[model samples]
Target: MVSEPSDAAVPGATVARLPYYLRALRDLAAQGVTTTSSSELAERSGVSSAQLRKDLSYLGSFGTRGVGYDVESLASYITVALGLETEHRLAIVGIGNLGHALANYSGYEARGFQVAALLDASPEVVGTRVAGHVVEHVDDLAAVISRDDVSMVVLATPAHVAQDVADRVVGAGVREILNFAPLALQVPDDVVVRSVDVGGELQILAFHAAARAAAL
Candidate 1:
């Protein structure tokens, strides 16, 4: 059984690693594994055993010294800690290629998030249907967000319009945003924005590959 989440402040780095640990735990559960050690989980999560243990420590004590951590219990605990205990409705803005693909993704619901609305600035695209959601006009962003009770937003618009869309999203009272646009967004201190620059990530990968090739 999952215990109540601790009120202690978890560091940002630890918070980031929590999802990885949760994923690893779930994989174990899927394989019919009921228990795991810090070392084993860390290897699966691509982190060190000591680091995994320290990160989980912020969530309060878990696991047994000899038998290791209960897979189901630890997964449940991490789920609560990561705020996945409740579903979060999302509004995906910009029905461009990337936005459309994101709206069609099947994984969100399993992870406790629902893509409740899809928005786009283009009139041609606005009334179209994608992923079972009829795209709404961007001008109706606030209304759609309010109507759907969306708690999070995914900004898939181009760089130039990302900030404008982000501002409107925040104005509508959503606190969490996932930005796939290429630029950094300026949001209020209370608002959290996670940017995914796919091109930038590819560039980083290319740099690593080049470095390896040079060394060889």
Candidate 2:
């Protein structure tokens, strides 16, 4: 594998690929597999062996050269690299239908993110329990973030309210946001926002379907 000088920051592509490595490592461990060769894991992760080695080098060494990698050790190292060594606390805003599903999702905890608070604007659903936390009014977002020490916020509100919610959370000291609402958000350069564009993904699928039919 090619080695570059010590990186001050992980490259964007490598950061994007870290989850695949982490998932492969964890899945292997669950199967009671202790040691794995690079090629073996590459097959499991769909990342080439060379790329896997390079990606893992970001964390130091894969493991002992002759014996291959120890599954549990590698997973732990990747977890630390991904900043999940210590769990990060987060809150989900807009507890409507989409928000309710996200709040109740167990996968977040499995990946080391704990949902600390839930917020919404509707008086009808406020104080209702979904995913173990009583839904608080959206007006209380700032107080909830402070009380829970929330570092991340997930936006699940309607398209119309997404930008406002994002502004409120950022002003309340949340720098990282995962926006599930189907709308573009305007935030300061210092703040980071990741958007989940479901419609765009569906459009791509539609394009592929049209191409297949045309070929036929």
Q: What tens-digit string does per-residue lDDT give for candidate 2 at 1-216? A: 223335566787888898988898899999999999999898899889999888777657556777888888788777877889998998999888898889888898889999999999999999999988999999999999999999999999999999999999999989999999999899999898989988999999999999999999
Please identify model 1 stretches exceeding 4 Å from their true place: 1-7
Candidate 1 lDDT over residue span 54-169, tens digit each:
88888888878888999999998889888999999999998999987899899998889999999998989988999999999999999999999999999999899999999999
Once superposed on the true structure, which residue ranges of model 2 sit more than 4 Å away at CA?
1-5
User: How many Å off is the CA of 29 in candidate 2?
Assistant: 0.9
lDDT of each: 0.92, 0.88
| Top lDDT prediction, candidate number | 1
Query: Which pairs of residues collide in model 1?
Result: none
- Deviation in angstroms for 91 in model 1? 0.5
lDDT of 2: 0.88
